[model samples]
Target: MAETVAARLLARLREWGVEQVFGYPGDGINGIVAAFEEADDEPRFIQSRHEEMAAFEAVGYAKFSGRPGVCVATSGPGAIHLLNGLYDAKLDHVPVVAIVGQTARAAMGGHYQQEVDLQALFKDVASEYLAEVNVPEQLPNAVDRAFRTALARRAPTALIIPADVQELDYSAPEHVFRQVPSGPPDAPSSVVVPAEDQLARAAAVVNAGSRVAILIGQGARGAADEVMQVAETTGAGVAKALLGKDVLSDDLPYVTGSIGLLGTRASYELMRDCDTLLIVGSSFPYTQFLPDFGQARAVQIDLDGRMAGMRYPTEVNLVGDAGATLRALIPLLRPVTDRSWRGRVEESVADWWSTVERQAMVDASPVNPMRIVHELSLRIPDDAIVTADSGSSTNWYARLLRMRGGMRGSLSGTLATMGAGVPYAIGAKFACPDRPVVALVGDGAMQMNGLAELMTVTRYQDRWTDRRLVVCVFHNNDLNQVTWELRALGGAPKFEESQTLPDIDYAAAARGFGVDGVNVSSPDELGDAWDHALTADGPVLLDVRCDPEVPPIPPHATFEQVKETTEALLKGDPNAWRILVQGVKAKAQEFVPGRR
Candidate 1:
């Protein structure tokens, strides 16, 4: 049989070493579906419950695998449904390639059924590279460019294929005028390093300061040792951006936990007291959390020159790979003789951890949300991959959970979207089937889209070598994050109509789909429940009834924020008394002599 464009596309993806393409079936992609049957699934088509979930799964796969994740969908609505997930990839700077079916060439402009302008829809999200393949000759170059552009730019790219073009017989571009030919699928590798003069200048700034603080993000993942060496040489306290939570192990004495709003007091203190700042591979946008402007001299090292000096007024912006750049700068640095700064940082970190443990142990009406993550921190496997959702639970995930050994963790960092935890875990499972994957999500997110993705989990559970995927749902019956935002940010009380969530038995829902389920309404059951789910033979969903009133207080809460919360409570918050009691107990831990 003559190779169709659809068959050629699949073959090219296989050649690029793509094991699977996360997507959904539709009539517009009939040719591609048929080719999958004929090709015997060389690159498996992992069908997701929704097109958005498919795109998120691709993003998650790319994030964990360090390769371009591929996702496909049908024309019009299916293509539109992929926007949010694609945006998540774009904002987070993940490499993903999306292939979408379009209307037949003849019916595109006629406004045929399920026909829409796909190129326009995808332009912003896949701004790095967007192509429409109208001819069979355009197939190879389009697919290849999509992958290359996505990898090079570290952003999402798109390929729009008309239905007719996909069904046409594949043909190679002739060696003639105006013909384009593509090279092999291999991407050229190189280590980028900044000029030696820039490295010397950066080192000079570090050498001049008596106290230094270092901040790292996902880009520093490969240079963990180099970052540690820099910290040791400069006597700097290392703080991680939320996305770089696993870049350095929290077990390090001078390693402060996450920075910014969902940050530790130690990190806040590190930033407040430091005179020199070194930021590597991170574009953390919250400038207020950084050392006050002009209070310190800062240097930023990033792969993209465009993002180098945007966050803070960095004195030297080094555009190079983090590992290479740090390696170059290390030789120029002078080891600090004054150990007082290092000692102070270590002391603060120790005090902060003790405060965190006490805060987690504070009493609540049902279960304290902080304790949920604290328990997981106690027993999480060294090699596990953890994913979190965007909600009040995120505060616990950012502060309480500790990363160590080969453990990796991530979420929708820039996008901050919910309903991604489950799909991200699913993607992580596919990326590293041997490693255990756990998703920390809120009950609101569970009801939003996670409940449906459980079927995706059950279907593919047998394919994973180690079938241990734990979805721990923080089953607090409220839109807890927004509730707090209303009180703290807007100075408004929680409106029940908008804040209340319909309570559902998430465990029963999981059980109906043939996955194990555990319900924990008491804090006492958390430890055992986590153990059971973590060691399960297949996917397990833990429905934990957490206390919604337990405040996700900022490490350094402002006076205005406290005043606003007080005002909101005085204006008749339904859980006002309980909220005050829990907040006091949680905050009081910091002031306790032994605990602090």
Candidate 2:
């Protein structure tokens, strides 16, 4: 018999290029952790107080490194916790591999301690799942599949090995592992280019149109320069979704900016005013914000076939990679050097930015959410990484914050999960301690996962600088923003307007946990608090009270929008009916209007 099963797995993991990971140890996983300890070339292991953090740290590592990040945990709660982070990875298109230790095979159904069905718990959340019932022979294949599926779809996958398997010794040659395949080219070579006439038709749409807007999603990052060239030649501008913000700089003359709530005013105005909107490489949601017949004609060019016609109707839905499709289409355009159309749209964008100076400005209000974000944005080192909690803070950051060339913003912007910001902030600081990291949270979300990290941060602060983690809480009392939106969506209002939260000092709660605490009741105190945290010797907490009535992520609904959208949809009023039809026409004339 060989010495131990966990030792062999550890050896193989080192061979698979794993360097650092996070997890918590337990009784069943003793052999596994011991095996980890016994290994000569041991990977660096960071301890997580909760299994959830263990999984999320892997998510952060994968996002920052663009590689598969690994996490480990014991059975029961450990294996069950792979859901949230795994789901986060899948939806965000990140690759993560979770190695969960299961209870002994014999003890599985006998009400054994820490025994649970990890396979069933993770089935829906994972892209691929493998259970190692036997050791040695099957282990390599299972590990390979976990990595392959995780990377293959750019999502999270799992490998669950029983504790008994980790203890059983099976001798085998160590050279059995094979390389993870680089994967096939996304689109097949058989996907032939459009015929010359089809290319000419798209080109005519490009050349004949005076004002064309190119909308890039996450699918457009690689072909950014080429898209810029097309816009340069064809009197067109660019509009990107929030995920596509990195495709071009916010300052680019041809690039009008992003088009969603996190977008710039100029980009939305451009998309709303163009003759034609050319969507490239994005499956962005929020169809309501897109240009319709009255605004602009939309011609989408996307790689994923499923995304076509999912949102706005397409005038000419071109199916191909953004770069490849643009390469094919540029040749067909009858080179027209007219600058009037492109120049005018850029002018409109400039005009929009001029009027939007109300954003991110410091005000004399006792507590201003925008001012707090603005001050942090200004004082925090330009390299600082920020994560926005899904609350008023999220809304505020989406409007007021800017990401420089090298800066990264972490949030589950797609799925919009509430508690991710705090955990992601902790994980980011753990990975990149040098960059100033601030986790901005609304009180509702901070309390969800905030306590889990107090121990970890306190213990690590002695060794690592306490300044790395600055937890800022917006103590607005109630779930004011969400309840407000619920009311906007036809739900009941949250009591009267003159309401607030119960009295309990959150800064005091943080102080009790051995973290730095600063209570900010006035805007005068915000800059000093943030500055203190930035310069402090450990992790700090800043609890600032932002009035609940401050405007949300997007400005509060205009009277026109409220009457046009709400009354028409909710009220039985005849006047509301006309606005509803008009709203539909405003959003859907591109696809098919006046017909549901």
Candidate 3:
């Protein structure tokens, strides 16, 4: 009896403890697909409607499990379709391994059907690690390298296997197949201890500063205790990047919410006033939100040495694990007893949150989007996993939803792509079946890919015991974010017809797909709808009629932005009047003593 390359590779995946691989099947991958069907191991193949969704599911799985996500696709078009989702993983630095099928090796360069230079196609996205298994003997090594590279680098990797190679008989001895030991795979972990000199220099920078503030990212998620200890010793306020939403409790008095365009007033003030910035495990790209090197002395700590001081210049670049570096530097710093600066900043945070609460409670005609999201934030279980789309929904989720009580979250981080929310919820549910999963998406994004992806939720709805997948669709019938951006920022007068969408009955569609469905057109109906979705026996799609008139105002507005809004309002744009009113109210609050 002889084992095929596909069999051996599948065996290796089992040895590496891969329980499943998300993918779609096609003719080009018939050999590998056949092998997958024959395998009696844990790495079962889960079929998806589209190759893109498969890749997004893989990225979502990695986010939930904190392990390398695996996905497979057929040749040419199948592989090409994966770029968007692969880019999602790449830009966000999530570990994903994409296995793509190729045309037979012998038929290369002869205009063969479904043939492509996969390595070249994936070079930019998977440039960190991309390879093809040209022969049977190379299969094991390619598998090992791809998985290892993805985990170590925290990026997507590609393995292109030609159809002929997948079918080739394994001529190596039986011992060769057993080279990879059968045990749990090595989990992703890092503990980069900086040199003593680097630690001392970083400590000296922190010790010298009177007003310190900390900026955290997803990299510091596991070091929450260390982050707080450093904050306590130095009397610093913490501003989180969107990815670091749960790095610390939202209720913490000194922990400011997210920074950047989606930031709070407290975070903006913290960045504006700090004399020294302590950056930990964050490669936050929006430099304008951070104080310039001239404005503040900085100390940066990152596990990857290359990322140290990449976003902002620093007095000391400590290349080490965030936890380890913070622990080492905490002892050398003196505790700040004068709590005056922190007290003022805390008051600002309180005032800002009160304003947010007022905005969320605003009684409007077409239901305010914030009201739905705020209600969701209050109604969702503590252990819920929320995945938000990239649009108006993201604006509400980022600003309103507070991550606490062991709730987890995932979104298209760096790429900031749409169509990831529903698939992400499905994948998150797959990875952690015991927890509740929710997808927050706008009408535009839901119509883009999420509606079709709901069938995927229907397909796997009964596979797990705890089926708490909820798709909360904001049916506003417009690409509200783009409309506002074009009007307010691009100097356009009104939203073009191209940016608007037809009203969709998403709840009806979900019911058509054999899933539970609810429709709410007003705020009064919201609570019961949420209750129905949360208590449903299977996946539920809640379609809430949302107001497209609400503007996604930033924490701080510039003069130019105000000018544009006034121009749009004078031009009699549909939503500009409400926006102008909101802007005026915000400006008035700014002038009010102790209100900002």
Clashing pairs in 1: none
Question: lDDT tens digits, residues 364-421, model 3?
Answer: 6568788887888778888889998999778888888877888888699789998999
Model 3 regions more than 4 Å off: 173-190, 582-596
Q: Which stretches of candidate 1 lie over 4 Å from their true place?
A: none
TM-score of each: 0.99, 0.80, 0.95
| RMSD of candidates 1 onward, in order | 0.8, 7.5, 2.5
lDDT of each: 0.93, 0.68, 0.84
Superposition error at 32 for model 1 (Å): 0.9
Ranking by lDDT: 1, 3, 2
lDDT of 2 at 132: 55
TM-score of 2: 0.80
Q: After superposition, how far is residue 571 of candidate 2 from its true place, in Å?
A: 15
What TM-score quantifies how close candidate 1 is to the native fold? Answer: 0.99
Clashing pairs in 3: none
- Output the lDDT of residue 152, model 1: 89
lDDT, candidate 1, residue 433? 92
Query: Per-residue lDDT for 1-596 in model 2, tens only?
Result: 46776776776667667776678887767778877777753776678777877777787667655567888888788777767777777777777888888888888788888878676788777746655545555666566667767776667888787888888885553543642222221212333344566566677777767777788876676687778778777778887676665566545666665577556556666766677777887877877567765566666777656678677776677777678788888877665467876777777555543333343342423476767776776677656677776776776565455555556666765767777766677667656767667888887776677656766777666544435678888887766566546445543434434333455677888888888889999887888998999888788889897765454433224465364436433644323344344334323322332221
